[model samples]
Target chain A: MGRRILFITTDQQRFDALGCNGGTVARTPVIDSLARDGINYTRAHPQNVVCMPSRSTMVTGQHVATHGVWMNGVALPEDAPSIALTLRQAGYRTALVGKAHFEPLLDPFLRFAENRMGRDGTHSEMFTMPDGSVVPHRGFDHMEFAGHGAAGNLHYVGWLRSEHPEVMGKFVPNLDGDLEVTTEPGGDTMAPQVRTTNDVPRGWYHTEWVADRTIAWLDSMGQDDDWFCWMSFPDPHHPWDPPQSELHRVDWRDLDLPAGYIADHEEREKVLASKPAHWMGWYDGSFVSNYEAPLKWVPATLQPDQVREINAMVHVKNELIDEAVGRVLASLRARGWDDDVDIVFTTDHGEMQGDFGLLFKGPYHVDSLMRLPLIWRPAKSAGIAPATVTAPVGHVSLAATFASIAGLPRPDYTEAPALPVNDDDARERGFERVLTEWDSVLFGKEVGVRTIFRDNWTCSAMLPGTLHDGTEGELYDHANDPLQRVNRWDDPSVRSLRDDMLADMWDHLPSVVSPRRTCDAPV
Target chain B: MAYIRRDIHIARTPAEVWGFLGEPARLHEWFPISGCRVEGTKRWIDLPTGITFEEDIHLVDNHQRRFVYSIVNNMLIKDHFGILDVVDDGHGHSIVTYSTQCTPNVLALVTAGAAGQGLAKAKRILEGGN
Candidate 1:
């Protein structure tokens, strides 16, 4: 019998947030246990730093260039080939439960048109064809959506209204609201930390709802049935709200400054000046500001204490995620299917998490933002030893890996290499370098950035005139400065290394002859 | 949320118009899906994108020349009900009025676009435009 696959993904979780990955703040024992029992890839990177592109890559096994979801606001083509479709064709039951940010929440198609017609409602559900057979979204036979906000999330909100009406009215809008305000140590102005403690009971939390539905689905499946489930969690991403019960599970007073945060502005300015114009704009509040803006630039006036408080909330969010994961695992064990299932735990992209004085992510593809924590636990019968793989891998390899685990022929359209799951010495034989791309129009300027990570050296370059009048780049020796504090692109010592990496990145550039236009269909 | 209703007069008979509009299986020819299946009063449609929608057919009256259906258990829409009425204009022509009500009423455009395209195609095929 094919092993049941339980794939879990978290949004905006950093690589170092797990205890198993040497994180000091977050308490992620359930996730840490997965690393202890499974194979952990320490240096896995996302093909793109943003949500939509990275998720599209994960499902389609195609790079952002091929999938055409290079940035937000673009939807993945309905007919695009997906891993879920491949697995279903091979007779495996597939389902996706949780956040699927495949399309922008505020798509123009969903907007009201002058003709009094528009596609209302979020397009996260399965599209019905004329025939009797239901087309699985991307290829999942069943989908349960629980998006970011209550207003946009139809399924979760419906449940909340029926099950916890009072809490829904009181807490849904304020999920991201600041519950506490305090004056910075010396500053006269109060810097409000965006954090909330949910009054809704633990059982009604979205995380628990996801676990409950997923477990109910698993229970309905026969013991002999083969299945592939993508249980995505929307938390630890933003709106930094954890249930009051889970928030108390972790003491915020125990948290400290993130590893790479440079509290000194003078030192930060020196580091920022050495990089591209967009990077400087992010620190100085010129490129983008405010959370609602499409371009996600950090505020320059953000205090260090505020950063610490946000990180503390992030840790609490991680704790809640861990508990949810634990409940799902326990359900699997109760059904006596734990031994027959293979689990993959990872995140879409990393959060800045106070790295280099930045809180969130944008054009910057620093290690803290690009690197991901990927752990794979095979079925007990596979007998794969728990070991750390230091080789470079990216989200592009997921579809191919899922196909391999299902014992099915890999689809012909996938561009990613099949992950080395069975090979015990895979780390020693992994890719020498991995590539990630970014293409978006930010601040009325089109920006394209690409980074090539080779061992301990990271190099990033921006397209000419995208950010400023001239082309710009950044190089960092992670071996000495893992926090990416200094840019050494012009340093004589690493010029040759930088040149080689840049050449490789240029070769990997996707050739664009004609970009695919958005679908103009009325629906 | 928005609302839209369109009435079109076609140079065809009501029976000829209902022949295409009443049959769920012919949805793909004019609508977006590839094919549709109807069991009792419930119809399920298959779109080109591989997703499916379950719609309940409320009224399929040949005498009244009206067809009513509502989408149920759909992710993108709620409380969606659609009505298609075909009336003999007493001059050997048929007038079809398509109306829809749904939450986030902006969906009126989707219904309008589909109705506009479907009715145009039905008129053409009935009047030998295809």
Candidate 2:
């Protein structure tokens, strides 16, 4: 038997959401312990600050341009290189048991196989390929998918409909009749993505279901087999709805405003105006660049209490996710696979979460949307030191890292090197800069953005768009302005620095895909 | 006549983005249609919802990076003409525009929305790599 790999990911989580990451709100002891005894990444960023692109990068270790899933609606090609597939080929049992956003969630006619899995009422059982070959779905020998809510033809939805059918309506309807995300105001704050009194029991919540299903999959594997299980949790993302029984964990009235949030409307507007036009455009309802942002909910109308409420909901949801992680770890311990398992904990991307009075995320390149809380707890038998890695890293390096953990050769298609331990290790491995990009055409508006993070400074280069010419962009020095309240893109002192960063970013970017795929679903 | 225009700047050469626009058989690659069949200057597009549109290809100007077509047999459309143009943005990128003019402005809204999505997808395909 070899060291097992357990990859756990949360959706749309911020760097400051964990206790070890200086987050005072969410008491995430389970993950914080991983940081205490493992390698904690302080400057990890996603290649793309969205779900499908970031998740694709994680699985393939390829850039957005390389994988070609540039935006949400576009699906990652079925035959795209997958870390699970690579590990499976290396004789490891692989399974992904949670939110696999590799395919868009907006499939009405079940065009994509991911959405069609549970359409016939069989959930998570091995699916047969179109050619009648009983192959692994995207490299996972077994799979189960759970999204934010009961919206899609997912395994979790099927289970809920069969076993706990009455609680099905407890979830806010994720999509409307047009197959678009519903923007109905929910919860006491009247926030568009919030649902206050979701009466779903804690046991029936998708978070618990994901953990349970992961444990079941692990239990099914032989004790001597080397396994790679990606236990993804689809919570703390949107609809801000945790099980009502667990909402008592955090109180909105007791919570303070997030550090990135500017309470004063005028001051927030001032900060937003300093950045790119889309920041203010999305906040003031002048433009809608991405379908992720709720159409009916105006950021300008977001109240301070609503931010507090949303933060509280996210905190409660985080605690639930932490508990879920603890339960899964307990399962590993019970199976005696604890010390031989390497656990990597991270998220797809960060949420805006009332940063500068912004609720959701879009093309913004600030830390709120870019920085991720990444922790890698290698197997105790590996004899690696626990240290803080400050050098820049991107989610694109995960596949190679998994390959290294599995003692297999890195696939030729994987781009980045394996994960590094400390600043010196990272520097030695040439892990100096992390790149993030945003290119989306939404609501008849096109936005093109490329960002590079290096030397504690973040720089973004915006292409010509409806609001401004290509000259507009954002530059922030984390050493001084950690919250990124001000932009220095146009500053004379940082002109050379910004120009160099932009040059490096553009020069390093991979070529874009021709004849890009269409976004079938609003998600 | 109701007129609608939508343009997207793709990070590719004008000619590369124009390839999908100018070719009738490649219409399904970027547009909302599920399949496309061409018979000489006449083309038929099948939507994912099972509706088919019969159209006549007006022009395919390779030098100008422009494509023009019109619906000849459709009950709901009444009269429709569509034009797609890919122009060089001078920054090694191309600005692809899709415009449509048709009777009954309400129908143009649907065409405009679909064109907007198609243009966005076109930009992604033109700029994204496998």
Which candidate has the highest TM-score of all? 2
| Each candidate: chain B TM-score | 0.90, 0.94
DockQ of predictions, in order shown: 0.05, 0.06
Q: Model 1 over residues A1-523: C-alpha lDDT tens digits?
A: 7888999998889888899999877778999999899988888888888787899889988878788876664566667778998898799998877777775443222321111111222323454544444565677876776654354434676677666787764343421212111111211222232435456687887778888878887887888899999998887775555666666655545667777787788887788888887777777767751122223224577777767667776887787788899999999998888888899999989887677777667778788788898999888877767778777778888898899888877788777776665335555555667788877642235677788888678898777655555357889888898888788878888889888999987786566415543322211
Model 2 has an lDDT value of: 0.85
Deviating ranges (above 4 Å) for candidate 1: A107-134, A169-193, A289-298, A422-430, A516-523, B1-130
Model 2, which residues run further than 4 Å from truth?
A121-135, A177-179, B1-130
Q: How high is the DockQ of candidate 2?
A: 0.06
User: Per-model TM-score of chain A alone?
Assistant: 0.89, 0.97
Which tens-of-lDDT digit does each residue in B1-130 have in candidate 1? Answer: 3355667788888888878777766776776455788898889987543557789998888889888898889876766888889888999789988887765443454455556656777777778876
How would the docking of model 2 be graded? Answer: incorrect
